[model samples]
Target: MTEQPRLTTREAAQRLGVKPETVYAYVSRGQLSSERAPGGRGSTFDAREVDALAGRGSRREPGTGGASGASGELSFRTGITLIDKDRYYFRGVDAVELATAYGFEDVAEWVWTGEPAHGSRFTAPQQFLDAARLAVDALPVHSSSMDRLRVAAVATAAADPLRFDLDPSAVLACGRMLIPTLVGALPTVGQHRSGEGRLARQLWQRLTSQLPDEASIRLLDTALALLIDHDLAASTLAARIAASARAHPYAVVSAGLGVLEGPLHGAASGLAHRTLAEVLERGGAAPVVADHLRSGRRVPGLGHRLYPGEDPRATALFALLGAIPQAADALAAARDVVDTTARHTALHANVDLALAVMSVAFGMPAEAGETVFAVARTAGWLAHALEEYAERPLRMRPSGHYTGPRPPRPLPA
Candidate 1:
């Protein structure tokens, strides 16, 4: 096959967050069928094949069990995952401190490659800059910066011969490099890469263009830190699955981006933002929210799969938004929602509500919420990809489909 193809078993395994044997299992389930390799001891698969197995894609229902093996509940797991019932961390370090104290470019490097602060001493290469610039310039007007990212990933992979290192430090560098180049291309704004500004700050500034001072930058910075990584979430699983196949960090991140694009994980901020906008626009938040509850509507941004009582990040952010006039209504709604939901289910607000609160406080346009999340979560994406590079098996397995009537097509059909 002359196609250079998309991915392989080991690679797909990384994204699936399963053992290589599991990938084979998936193949057996017909969730993922194997493609022929030249000499055939094992079958090769592509990113799309695994994507199809995700239960949202083509092969989805297969006569039963929608999206199995996810193990659903966010419980204790096999890896050393750091959780934040209230505060985010990297192993043990407080993420808020890192976001506040460190430069975003530095933070991006740390997350992508897991290098210590000292490692960013080297600058991004010129060849990378030139190619990244061209990629940015060539992007079509129809695509958002997020879509442009797909093109950028392809370009970056082809331009850099050294893009495949799985070492923590190596992938970290890729993350730092990738975010800046991509954000630099967004429309109605420009990414600041020089003279005292960092990439994270630049992204924040662009996304929150309607905000005041450096406060939005600081808030965005911490948000990114807190969100950078959290073990094997579905999207992170996608990145890891790509990496285990020996694909480079860029490819892993790209696969992860695909998962992030899915509504289940990354689109909450936008959804919450839209809801709050309506509540705020309709006069009083409390009454409107009360009406929603009376109508049996579930409020967005009020719950999490993990933290039941409270999301620490949400708490911190809510506190920050309390004094801002623009955010007052959303903040008030959050308070009532918390009070109402608190008495019923143990569920309290998560980062989504707080983000909506901040979006209003910072005076950012409603659409900015999604972009802000994508910016911050990019850190987490890089971290997950690095994990793929460093871990073993690094493969995703799925059962195969035996759909086409086994032996023959009877020639004339």
Candidate 2:
């Protein structure tokens, strides 16, 4: 086969109408692949791939009011997190910094109220916790963690007479209670520590039987904080839509949970966990990656559309996981997967991969990452719901673009 001509990084960036850094981001995201130059100095990309990507970008006509062209975009003003240049910020503060410096409860409180509530805690009311647990326990033995959470949300809503109250204070109160209830409802693998002071400590008992060290607990706490919100994720959007329809806080959470079942979203970590476990068992990433590709499945936990470069969440968690001596093997397994996949398509590890590392390292089940995601993201769903509630009701309803047979002509048999 004749060798294909290649474009240098600068030329690729120019061809794609993006910066050199963005070209590198494209490589990291697996949107484009690059190879080391002959002398191993700089990277080069296939000319065809760069042109193809540019062609895709050019499809959207400029000045059409939205990135999708004439149909426009559904945009809402949000004072929450902002993602820019591979870094995300929560209310103007760096999310990674906030997560590292403060506990999940404190960070969630800050995201909710725009000010840090030092030493903040989320405690489930006995009534709500009991209701949620009863609902979760009633499920079949084979039910997944997300199934329990969805049912718990409904049960907690039924138990709360004040759930209909949409006042900001009332909603905030519900958020504080609801988060803990969700965590408390899960079946504990070990002896339940119901009275643990920190939410992280409380959740620790439910996730694994092994006693957690200080560093492990800190890792869990940071993971929760980092995941608290990520601007308009699919589940967050679902929650906002429900809130736009005046659904109660618990219903808003239910809406979010409803969307979390998709393989691409909250369940992604579970998939990644299984993959990592397989890699550990198989003893190498090559055959596993090959199997995944041969089956036509994009390796889960590899790339994220929002982050072109490295996922900041993964970077932070990997840093923390590095400090933990027990995580070394799982961490090495994760790196091997990333490195192996990179040879074919340059993709960076996303948060799902990091979550997988934690789950695999701590002897947690495959679904454990999903459980953690559901519990942590519940706070974010509520935060978005609160914002949506303040807007004009039903504002999210958009007119569907009618593409079928023109109105009267569609009345045929």
Scored by TM-score, the top model is 2
lDDT of each: 0.63, 0.86
For candidate 1, report its TM-score.
Answer: 0.70
Q: List model 2 lDDT by residue over 1-413, tens digit each.
A: 88778999998877766668777766665667788999999999998877776655422454321122222233556788999979999999999999999999999998998976899988898989999999899899999888998999999999999899999899999999998898889888876555468888988888889889899999999999999999888898899999999999999999999998887789999989999999999998888999999999888789888899989999999999999999998999899999999999989999999999999999999888888888889989889888989888976554332336655555557
> By lDDT, who's the top model here?
2
TM-scores of the models, in the order given: 0.70, 0.82
Candidate 1, residues 282-315: lDDT per residue as tens digits? 7545665666678997777877777656787677
Once fitted onto the true fold, the runs of candidate 1 whose alpha carbons sit more than 4 angstroms away are 1-80, 84-88, 96-130, 136-142, 165-169, 188-196, 286-297, 323-326, 340-346, 401-412
Model 2 steric clash pairs: none
lDDT, candidate 1, equals 0.63
Candidate 2: list runs displaced more than 4 Å. Answer: 1-71, 192-195, 405-413
- Model 1, position 129, has a per-residue lDDT of 56
